[model samples]
Target: MEVAQFIIQILNGLSYGLLLFLLAAGLSLIFGLMGIINLAHGSYYMLGAYLGLTIMKTSANFILALVGAATLVALLGLIMERVFFRGLYKQELDQVLLTFGFIYIFMDLAKYLWGGTPRSLPTPPLLEGSLEIFGAAFPVYRLALIVSGLAVALLLRLFLEKTRTGMIIRAGVDDKEMVTALAINIKLYFSIIFALGAFLAAFGGVMGGPVIGAYPGLDFEILVLALAVVVVGGLGTLRGAFWGSILVGFIDTFSKALFPSFSMLTIYIAMALILILKPSGLLGRMELS
Candidate 1:
């Protein structure tokens, strides 16, 4: 590849990886704190994209659509956690089955609601056009995504490391019983965190809509990729998810460029190697099952 093309590819990898980080960050938090592998998480992402599309088309307001879709999904997450997941807390099998079922239910709902048409969200005019980098013109929106992802990473780090609720959450993850003993409403905290995770997924969906678009089977595809990201990044740390996304994003992007038909295989190979070398992941504290 030419130097310009290679440089653009690097940016492409970073942009795609950042998008995955948005999705995987939430997945990591939910599983790390609650030990529930939420298969439906991807459904939320899809719903968010579709919802953002609808709102944007109707209101012609991208920001409104982004926040609205994410807020609605977060509410749904809060409800699901309280109504269903709460009962299945310790029952891993039940949790898995229930969430998996929700995936189909959600997919069907999306079909019924939005039809099977693939749609793309509009990029703000402010981010339209391309910028010259290394003699290659790169999409401005992608650069925005990179910046947004980094901003989110910093914010999340601060939130988890510098805030009381975040501190309580970390504590609860380590020792739920002890947190409860201290009069902390661990269940409420869990509900909030779960909703927050959902929020992030939906936010990611909207954030990614302009690039990946909304489509009929996108949910499972995104879910699988996001799962790989968190698993490779290590289950419990935001830092892991960030770096994992960058690495996986690069692997997937470069593989597609070089071996388009077998890109996913490369990712799996990389993930397998990582798991072999460190079963706990690059920075994971939780054990993989």
Candidate 2:
């Protein structure tokens, strides 16, 4: 029974970690590629949760809710990037202040639209059950979360590594001026990347809503966790994001289960150790710092 419990906990950690990756990946990309200090990224996640909840309640379709929320947030991202963020590029302080301002605006909008009550989406009927793994009944929804995260991760990896657009984006990350010199539309690229990042964040939010619920301060909570993931995973590297998410996810889940009173402390301790031992993170590029 003890062994079974441990295995279940590990599975839980993996699901949670992958979810963290979904949030961190886009963040890493924006910061690494575009050098935008978007403190309001978490607000997109909150927005998605609220929008997803509303759509799920009305349409009774989780997939549609996901699509709707992601699309809307992506548009929002585009608008913010083109109108507000474009001039602030590389001006870290200005970017931070602007995005920070948006955070409050978004939070207020959420309260006005959805009220102050917390909301949660029910697990879709198709995934509302459990599957026996090693004699323990693990939640099917969690298993699905794991699968979805992995699928998205794999697709993103391919998009980054295998596609021409991915190659250009990577080259842009390395030398934006050069790409611009080559007559590439840097502004358009930035807008697209920003929107893509927002889409990913919102998608993750929809997936996480059933588990974490939509609440007024959720943006701040998730922002902290996502920032932790980004920092631990090493800034600006997808590989770092993947491993960092898994490491932080497992540590957090296990600590909460085994040492509930010291969960927060344990996570920070682990982060401190990682920073001391591998300052660039496990898979992060050393040049990033």
Candidate 3:
């Protein structure tokens, strides 16, 4: 490949990786703090995309659609958590089964409303076009995604570090009982965190709708990748998610680009090698699993 082509792939990889980070961040937080395996997490992603499309068509405004979709999905997540997840937290198998059911329900619902065909979202007018760098042009939207994902990551790190409530959350992740003993409302804190994760996942879906067309099976496909990210990054680790997303993103992009003959096999090889050398992942702490 030429230098420009290589740079383009790197940009593409970084953009894709950032989107994965958004989904994986939520998955990690939910798994780490609540100890829940949410098989239906990707459903929220698909939901966000459909919602974005609907909202955009109705309002004729992309920004509003994005905001409205994210808000609606976050609300849906809150409902799911309150009605289903709260009870299922202590029951891993039950949570898995329930969420697994949700995946199919969401897929069927998407098909019924949006049809079985794929749909696309256009980049908003303001963010359309390319930026020149090292004599190569790159999509402005992809660059925006990188910036937004990085900003969110920074905001999250600050939230978990600078504020008292954030400190409580971090403490909870490390030792729930100790944090609870300090007179904190563990339930409330967890609920907020869960909602936050949902927002992240849904937001990612909305932003990625343009690049990765919204379709029926997108949820399962992204879910598998997100699961791998969580496994490779370590459950309940934010920093781990960042590193793991970048690593997996690059591996995924390059494998598909360079090793078209064995693209799928290469990902498995990478995963296996990582697991063999570092079972806990690049930045994850050892878990009981």
Candidate 4:
């Protein structure tokens, strides 16, 4: 491949990697903080995309659509946590089963309301073109994704490290019982963490909708990928999610670009290798008891 083409592919990979990180970060956070394995997480992402499409189509304002979609999804997440997930934590298998059922229900609801057809959203006017970088032209929206993802990552790191609530969350991850015994409101923390995770997943879906058309089966496909990411990155490790997403993103993207025949299998192969070598994952710590 030409140098320009290779550079373009790398940019494409980084964009994809960033998107994966956005989605996986939420999954990692919730699992890390609450020990709740939410299968419906991807449904939240789909909701964001559908909501964004509806808002943009109705309001004809892309920024408003993003804000509206994210807010709606975050509200839904809060409701789900309070009404459902709070009680299901003890029943891990049941939580998994319940959320899995929710996945279908939410997807069907989306289909009924939006129909089974794929929907597309227009990129914002400001992000509608390519930029010349190192003599290679790359989509401006993709560069936007990279910037946004990195910013969010940094902000999250700061929140978890510098803020009081963030410190509590980190403490919860380290030892929930001790933290609770210290009189911290673990329930409240769990709810907030869940909502935050939902926000990230939903936001990722909204951002990605313009590039990857929103379709009926999008949630299921993305869910599988997210699960792979969580497992490979090690459960509940935010930093692991970042590195794992980039690794998976680059492997899948580069393989597709260079060896199209076996591209699809590369991610799974990488996951298997990671599991075999380090079952706990690259950054996974023992779950708090």
Candidate 5:
């Protein structure tokens, strides 16, 4: 391949990797801290895309769509946690079943609301065109995605490292019983984390909508990729999630470019190799199942 083409592919991979990180970050946080297997997480992403599409279509404001979609999904997550998931704490099987049930409900609701046809959000005018990078034209929207994902990651890291709530959350993850015994409102904390995770997933959906489009089966497609990211990156570490996403993104993108026939198989092969070599993942603290 030409150098410019290779550079473009790398940029594409980086953009995609960042998107994966956004999707997986919440899943990593929830699983790591709460041990809850949230199967409906992907549904939240799908909802975000649909909601964003609606908002953009009606208002022609991309920023509003993003904020509105994320906020709504976050609220839904809070409600789900308080009403449905709170009682199911530590009951992994029940949590899985309940979330799985929600997946179907969400899918049905989406179909009813938006019909079966796929939809896509229009890129903002500011990010509508392309720019030359290494003599190659690259989409501005994609570059924006990469920047947004990185900025969010940085902000998240700062929040977790510098804020009191972040410290408490970290402590809770280390030992939930100990944090609860200290009179901390562990339940409230969990709720907040759950909501935050939902927000991130939704935000990712909005950001990714232009690239991937909003489709009926989008939830499952992204869900599978997000799950792969979480598993490959290690269950509980944000650092792991970041690196894992980049690795998967590059592997998938480059394989598609260089070996079209093997693209589908490459990522799985990478995952299997990683598991064999480093069962806990590159930066993950938890063991693989």
Candidate 6:
């Protein structure tokens, strides 16, 4: 492979990794704060892709599709939290079973509503172009995706590190009972976090639509990847999600280039090795109780 090709590959991996970071970051936050292993989390992404596509087709507005899809997803998440997940807190088996059931339900809905056909969200006209990189014409859209992911990361860090709500959230993660004792509406925060997770998943999906497309079984594939990110990046830290996504993204991308047939196998092997070396993950802290 030439240097240009390798550089392009690196950019590809970085773009993909950043998507995974935002996607997995939501899962990590939810689990860290709420102890919920939401098996159906990927459905948020799937639905977002399909819905965003629909919105774009109807309105021809990319920004609308993104915000609209994410908002709808967040609303659904709130409903799930209030209607189902609220009662299942700390009940691991129940949570798993409930969320797993929703996955099937979502799959069926996607099929019925969108059909089995795969679809791709077209790149916005404003972003339709390429940039020369190492003499390679890398898609400008991809670079935009990378920048968007990084910007969101920065915003999230600020939200979690600087804001009063963020401080409350962190304190809640440390000790919910104590936070509750302080008369803070921790329950409302839980709902907010759950909705926020769903929103992030949806945002990732719409942004990734042009690259990965909307299709059946994509949810499960994303779920596996997100789970892998969490496992490798540790349970809940944003730092862990960032580094883990980059590492996993690079390994997965390069392995696919070299051995397409055994790409997933390579990822698993890398994950196993990392686990053996550091069980909790590179920058992961003690799991929140």
TM-score of each: 0.97, 0.96, 0.95, 0.95, 0.97, 0.96
For each candidate in turn, give its C-alpha RMSD to the true structure in angstroms: 1.3, 1.4, 1.6, 1.7, 1.3, 1.5
C-alpha lDDT of all candidate models, in order: 0.89, 0.87, 0.84, 0.85, 0.89, 0.89
Q: Arrange candidates by lDDT, highest first: which order?
A: 1, 5, 6, 2, 4, 3
lDDT of 3 by residue, 27-82 (tens): 88777777777787888888888888888888879888878888888887788878
* Over 4 Å off, model 1: 287-289
Better of 2 and 5 by TM-score: 5
Cα misplacement distance, residue 41 of candidate 3 (Å)? 1.3
**lDDT: worst 10-residue window of model 1:** 28-37
lDDT at residue 253 of model 2 (Cα atoms):
93
Q: Candidate 1, after superposition: displacement of residue 139 in Å?
A: 0.4
On TM-score, who's better, 1 or 2? 1
Model 6: ten consecutive residues of lowest lDDT: 280-289
TM-score of 1: 0.97
lDDT tens readout by residue for model 6, 1-289: 8999999999999999999987888888887778777888899999999999999999999999999999999999999989997787668679778989999999999999999989999999999999999899999999998999999899989999999988888888778889999999887888988899899999999999999999999999999999888778887788888888888888888998988997899778877876888877776765433
Model 2, 1-289: lDDT tens digits are: 3888999999999999998888888888888778765788899999999999999999999999999999999999999998988777668778879999999999999999999999888998999889998799999999999999999999999998999777778888888899999998877877878898899889989999888889999998888888888778888878888888998899899999987997988767877887789877677764635
lDDT of 5 by residue, 167-252 (tens): 88888878899999999989898898899999999999999999988889888878888888877888777888898899888988
Give the per-residue lDDT digits (tens) of candidate 1, residues 138-184: 99999999998889899998999899998988887787789989998
Weakest ten-residue segment in model 2 by summed lDDT: 280-289
True-structure RMSD for candidate 5: 1.3
Candidate 5: worst-modelled 10 consecutive residues by lDDT: 280-289
How well does candidate 6 match the true structure, expressed as C-alpha RMSD?
Answer: 1.5
